[model samples]
Target: MNTAAFSSLPLNPALLENIASLGYTHLTPIQAETLPPILEGKDVIAQAKTGSGKTAAFGIGVLSRLEFNRFNVQALVICPTRELADQVCKEIRRLARFTQNVKVLSLCGGVPFGPQLGSLEHGVHIVVGTPGRLQEHLRKRSLRLNHLKVLVLDEADRMLDMGFEEAISDVISYAPTHRQTLLFSATYADPIREISKKFQFKPITVSIDSSHHDSVIGQHFYQVDKARRMSALGYLLAYHRPESTVVFCNTKRECQDIASTLDNCGFSVQALHGDLEQKHRDQVLVRFANKSCSVLVATDVAARGLDIKELQAVINYELPWDPEIYVHRIGRTGRAGKLGLALSLCTEAELPRVKAIEDYQGVAAKWDEVAPFPMAYAERFQPPMVTLWIDGGRKNKLRPGDILGALTGDAGLAGSAIGKIDIFDDHAYVAVSQDSVDEALAWLKRGKIKGRSFMVRKSQWG
Candidate 1:
């Protein structure tokens, strides 16, 4: 959509300011095609890859149509995890920056339910949340979706893959029958098709793909003995040191072990898996997204459906059971026309899986012998000694500014002296520069934000 066309839409003027401020010179392919249909209240099942501006397409539509003064949920956006839900909420808030009185609440598992229930009692116009948490709220009689006019299933296939189908159905059942339904996914599987068949009525369909699988990805594989794999991975990380990388593991135990080994080797690391509590999972994801933690040791299931822009590399510690998943794993990088790197360590036993992946992808992945091990690289891996999480968040009207204020203003630390600040629903996370850790902690313990003292510590913001 052109700027003039966007201006002509029935939207708040502040939203327009936000749009122009964000330098949205023109709409992306998905945005241009999906915006008009969504504006018309039509059901849509759009297949668009990450970084195609799909979030803005739906966010603006929902914000434009939300009845801000109704004091009831009018739009519901369901995501697979707290991280993605928080991200969606942030984007929607930016689009609604000019829209007055638009309250976007994020309901996800992790934080206490009392505060969420209290917020519900007050009122909310737009609800963005995980499927299970939204269902929980509905069961508790806190989130009233009876007035919902739009139901959005973002990353729909991922939700299904994560076993959220039943919860999604229950939440949607609470919404009005005439509500508009919009589904977005990286791929359209049969289960997703089943969802569309039942919840979406004659929806307009959209799919974006490259001419060939290899056209969209850069692929590579490496042959190594089983015992030397970890050392080889450590050497690779130290040599290449991509800005952001996701290390794919086959099992949760491996994810933890590799992360532990990397930490002991002097690298900042974190693990993402279903075994973690919702709150810690949110912290790990936030840190990864913000570059506070550059390496994510994750199971394929845990890493699937994550949408992180600017990921530089993908290292396969374990080949997936499915070839398409291998494609998806590497596809995390090389997204949006950016050149990407994919490296895999193939043992003699796992060469079959690597061959299967390459064969299924219809592309040849070049392999090379492992060069001599580098003790210099392995020596650099030191675990991040500490991480800090602030008790304040969006739910408490916390902003990055507030967290910064408490850190640099009252706490009297230099801005550069602080690290990443990730503010979510019921909390905010701030990384302290190793140089200023002690002082930062002491200053925080003595200061107040927004005229109130908040709980601050070296822990996840649960």
Candidate 2:
């Protein structure tokens, strides 16, 4: 039997069928290495990058050992960010499709606390959340881990980087000491090893190479005068004009400044930083993910846990101090068998950082010169899609299919004119092609979704 096949694992028949239905025939390297130990109920620490099927490996393990009959929290997944927590919850729910009653809930900050308390009151089988929020719930006695058989620290390094080490320890204090603990991180740094020593029992360690290949990601370094950095960025944007781009800034202030400058330069752009309210962060992420925004300026911490598919480019406005961070930033693009572009702007002071990166990757830096491009070229930089915000969502029983049906039916828009449709608890965002924005918006405002009226309007940033 091929060990790479999902069927080779000792999974429940229903789960095997669901995995096949979901089109996962073979295991990713990370999954193949980690799942066996995970399913065997052993403590494991795995090093793997994002988009590497790490979630499925852990999700399947959690589900396989789940006690659906008992409503208590049997498994806990701690993430660094709310976006990541929500994403993990969704993926686990999809994996749990084999059993509809396997309850999973997200407990993250930046949202209402009352709802989380209410969900806890009702009970859940699995809880995926940020460390801070989970610690809070544990403190309030609203959440208990006495029944937790499995505990997973997803992106453990990122959680530690976000200063959640103390909080993570606090949450762990409440869990059963003998339970299985799984730690997954992109980089196995010294701190990660320390945490593993402190928290995990004797564990199996699995590592997958996290390096990006030159053939997949084309990297270019441009030397610029310290004062001319913004112009160089504008030149790069105008010269390449990728459909979707993420500009990585080293600081929150720089992230906001670059986003404001790009927006002022007539580029559809948004900034993601720690300072923004959660609602604004959601809007920015939605616009960028739905292709309603062309450029996203974000700090590394702010951009953590962002899973954007088909990202065309990643630009480092300023080089990070660590080569590992550089590798992580550029790794966001050039995924899924598509060519990825990584452009970096460097000054005389930043050459050492570039050298650090070169030594880390074992490849010489590819240098390029930046020249001013015609400002008129920016006219073509407008995003191809426009997003419409609907004030009704899961709370109102509104779904993506309802919104899509309304637009394509009464709105008379072609299916191709519709883009990504995202539904939240109390609101939703639908992306329509720029040419069909007016038509979609008009129909959404005049017509009804699921036979009920909704407050619909064009997103301000769209």
What TM-scores do the predictions have?
0.85, 0.97
Cα RMSD to native, each candidate? 3.8, 1.7
Candidate 1 residue runs with Cα over 4 Å from true position: 1-14, 210-217, 335-338, 348-362, 374-379, 382-398, 405-417, 424-428, 432-462
**CA displacement after TM-score superposition, residue 155 of candidate 1 (Å):** 1.3
- Model 1 poorest 10 in a row by lDDT: 376-385
Candidate 2, residue 270: Cα displacement in angstroms equals 0.8
lDDT of 2 by residue, 1-462 (tens): 134899999999999999999999999889999999999999999999888889999999999998788999999999999999989999998988998889899999888899889989998999999988898899899999999999999999999888999999989999998899999999999999999999999999999988888888999999998888998999998889898999998889888888877877788899999898888899999999999999999999999999998899999999999999999999989987799999999999999999999999899999999996443324667899998999988999888889889988887899999999999899999999999999888887889999999999999752
Off by over 4 Å in 2: 1-3, 374-378
Q: Return the lDDT, model 1, position 319.
A: 77
Show the colliding residue pairs in model 2: none
Instruction: State each candidate's clash count.
Output: 6, 0
Top candidate when judged by lDDT against the true structure: 2
